[model samples]
Target: MGEYKPPFTITNKILSYISSISEKIGRITAISNLETKPHLRRNNRIKSIHSSLKIEANSLTLGQVRDVINGKSVLGEQKEIQEVKNAYIAYEHLEEIDPYNIQHLKQFHGIMTRYLVEESGEFRSGEEGVFNGSQCIFMAPPARFVPQLMDELFSWMKESKDDVHPLILSSVFHYEFVFIHPFSDGNGRMARLWHTAILSKWKPIFEYIPIESQIEKFQDEYYRSISECHIAGESTIFIEFMLSQIDKILDDISVQINEKNEYLPEAVQKLLEVMEYDIPYTSNELMERLGLKAKEGFRRNYLHPAMEMKLIQMTIPDKPNSRNQRYLRC
Candidate 1:
């Protein structure tokens, strides 16, 4: 086996960036401990953003990523878009059941590429190219490397004793795994998913960080950083780039948390918590649960306020007379 050595100059810069971001992430972690519905909403919003970004990055067309971020559905591409959404939903649930195992990886990849690509859940069995500019630069290791590399990665995850921060470890693992490019087609998506799994193991809050969105925001820079570090034989620059994105995303969520704390009504907030586990409620169902005498009273006093605050949304906005008209916690 070749001994791994990182580029010193880029490593130094990355370590510096990690140090700065760690302090900011610490603050976000602290605030997340407050047990409030608005805080929970903020957390869910972050998770939604993260899931959306992961789906967009993996399955959607380049233009689709922009459309999804802009709060628009890909109109003619519903099937493809739904596949991405399903992938995110799968990750959200499956990670909790088994985060690091290969089973989860296969499931994520399957959902990510269901109708979009033929090699959805399988690893690449032949040679693959890594491009730089117009040139094919690095050739991924042969098919034999896939199992060995994956085993080494999981073993390293299990046996590593150094108290290296989870964020740093996750970022490094991401870069290295993608560099290895174990899969034929979905290597990038797998790297991002595994990174989330690694971080979520450390702190559940990280599962909601939307690091991918930040990556998509600086996609060009992200690619450049990875390529530069790869060519220079250092993973540190990639680590630094990831850490900075994590910090920025955490800060963004923190602001939303604080805003929700200040403005949300207490009763409506309580309603939100109750519905977190079970959403999409009808007016009668909500009134019954809230113990209000009149359904109209509940709508005027509770639901409308929540809707106006953008905390809840009507699932059937056009069907006023429909008994099935429901409200969902957004």
Candidate 2:
């Protein structure tokens, strides 16, 4: 296969982003216990799915996305809910798919667009464009050229995997995927999901970093970056924007982990385990169960942190010092 080279120049801004992201990645991976924290991983996955879908105007709220992920039934538009299910299934198999394989890309698009599109796994057979309220913002390539274009892109990626940093490669792939608008539907979702797959292949920690959440927070800038790159005939701006988002996501996760660990220390976790979800218990009982003689120490370390995190709630908030005051796991 011939090499595929898209028009893009790497600038100082791009290099700076790549360097910052690398440092953040190193810092996050230095946390010895992070990978073992399944709760945090699951939370990040849910956020990733929800924010990516939200960018596409999927109406499911983040809470609703969590419920769906936990297998709890949620009431919503059938199609929107199905989109969530399909996207979840695709993400769940991130390790199984090769990011540089065209077939795997199509398979993921199939999984992501199942039941939502008539041609789930196939490239578009007709015209496609990025549209906004009756205006065509970007027109994709002709449909007939898609198969060749995709093959060349994947071939280039496979060949360049070692030479290119994944931060740049994934971001470039994302822009090119959107630029191609390959599928009849679900192009945006595919772009986001596939980029995550690319990054996860580079470093497994990325599977847990929900960069899409950061993208959703700056949706307008995201679109503008893409459009600017489209007009400029290069993906430099998009790559810069994506790497910035990735860096911000890492910062957010660091803050979240620090806050979570601070609020839920080992002592607080032990206290939580002893308390019932609904049953209220007095401070004396809680302290006694922990074999603690010092009331002030118990409150300072275990009780206060848990309460501040809202994992437990005071039964008598209005009378904190009352003799009858009690607390229950919130």
Candidate 3:
């Protein structure tokens, strides 16, 4: 095989983000005791699949994604619904995946793109380009080079596992995988799922972090980072961005855990767990975090009750959904 040294210059900023992410990962590992509860684990896996597919423009809402995963019928385009199903199937087999195995990578792509693409598990025979509407943002290397390039990349990853930090390695792999654009379809989803696979191998807590949920929240930035990395011919920016997302997700989980431990009334406790005491969060963010699907029901039961209980306060007292609407704990 060729000598595979991925292109990326590590800087202090990258180091700083990696250090912060590592600390957060350590904290999460300690808090989780390396054991994620079954219900929470399932919820996170659903969120990961939903958010990743949503980033790819799947029309299914998180609620509908949950329904589909639960074996309930969801009203959406058949392809989108199938995307959710395929993602769940791939994630269910995460335990059996060898993250550094190239064959496993193709297997995952097959599972993730089953019935959704003509060339499901196979790398593209034709060339590929990433398009944003009429604009072509990225073009992959020639089709003939894919197998060799992917093999070299995986070989580099396997060799670098001990020398490089998992956070940096996973982020680098994610950026490079997208840059390669090996598959005819499902490359974006594969990049995401594979990065999570890499991280879960390093720390089991990552299997439950739902970093894809955070990525969906920052979708524009996510693409921008990739575009910038492609232009720069290095993965540094993308690595930093992914590590930041991971750190934020870890912070949110930590906040969720600590807030749940607080002594509060049953009605407002869930609200408090979702809210930040200092930083304001949008109602949608809070509701999504709490898994509340109905805005009216959420307001009447959770939001209004929390407000009435003097436990949470609105950023704009007069305007609920305008003029910078957000909520924070009292």
Candidate 4:
């Protein structure tokens, strides 16, 4: 087995920051589970935003991340659009599988890389390069080291018994794996997805935490952290950067939860509870579930009130009159 080395002083500073962030993650988890209509909506929107950001960040082709959030066909051609749609579907399905399972990881890779590239889920069998413009900046381990690195990662994840914090492990693993750049493409996105998977496995609040938004907010910092780690021969700076972002995200959610606790109405609150896990409601669906005779009445009395408070966002932003319009608890 290969022995892992501890990072030095600069790396220790990063780990210390991560420790602080991990402490707050517990608070964020508590706030997420609390009963509050406004906070629930805020949390849900954050989750949606983060998921969307993940898709944009992970895509091989470049486009505005906003285009993805607005549901525009930024990928252009039919084949490219189909590939992006497939990736979204696969990401949604990630909730159903265990991230710790190596099989599931490979499956995610398969779905993520399908049609985008020839290798897809398979690991690189030869040399790889990281480049900026015309210059190559760094090269990963030799081809022979690829399988062993993956094996060690899987084994560490499975056998870790020290109550090592999942978020910490996730940050560390994300940096290390991306550094390895095991696959031919999609390494950055895969690392983020895998981090979420690991966190969700540890605490379900991670399912709602939109870490990607924070990443997108500081994309340059994110890249810099990774590069710094590469140059310094330590994972600590990257870990600290990730943890600090998570801390801020959780803090934001906590404030939103507190505000929701103060002002959300009872009917709207109950609706939020009902739709906590499953969302995307139509007028008819709301009428059926709430046992109301008139769809308009239900909207005026229940849905509109929630919408006014921003507890629900319209699915059809442009065409409110469309029969296909749906409401999701955002």
lDDT scores in order = 0.64, 0.84, 0.82, 0.67
Q: Could you tell me the TM-score of candidate 1?
A: 0.66
lDDT of 2 by residue, 1-330 (tens): 655777778889889988998887887777534555665677778888999999888999987887787788999998988999998999899888899889998999999999889889999999999754355669999999988888878887888889988999999999998888899989998899889889988888888889889999998888889889989999999999998888888888776555445545798767865664345789999988778999999989999988888888888899999999999876
Q: Over the stretch 1-330, how does candidate 3's per-residue lDDT look in tens digits? A: 547788888889888887887887676666554242454566678889989998888888877888888799888899999999999999988878889999899988999999889999998999998754456678889999998889889989989999998888998899888888999999989998999989889877777779999999998888888889888989988988887888788888775554344455564766764553354778788889888889898888888888886778888998876857988776
Candidates arranged by lDDT, highest first: 2, 3, 4, 1
Query: Model 1 off-target regions past 4 Å?
Result: 1-22, 33-74, 97-100, 115-117, 130-139, 259-330
Top TM-score prediction, candidate number: 2
Clashes of 4: 1
Q: Identify the runs in model 3 with alpha carbons over 4 angstroms from their true place.
A: 33-36, 259-330
lDDT by residue for model 1 (76-144), tens: 456556555555555556346344476667677777667666767777778786654355546777887
Candidate 1 — what's its lDDT? Answer: 0.64
Error of 3 at 91 (Å): 1.1
- Backbone clashes for every candidate come to 0, 0, 0, 1
Top-lDDT candidate index:
2
Estimated TM-score for each candidate: 0.66, 0.84, 0.79, 0.70
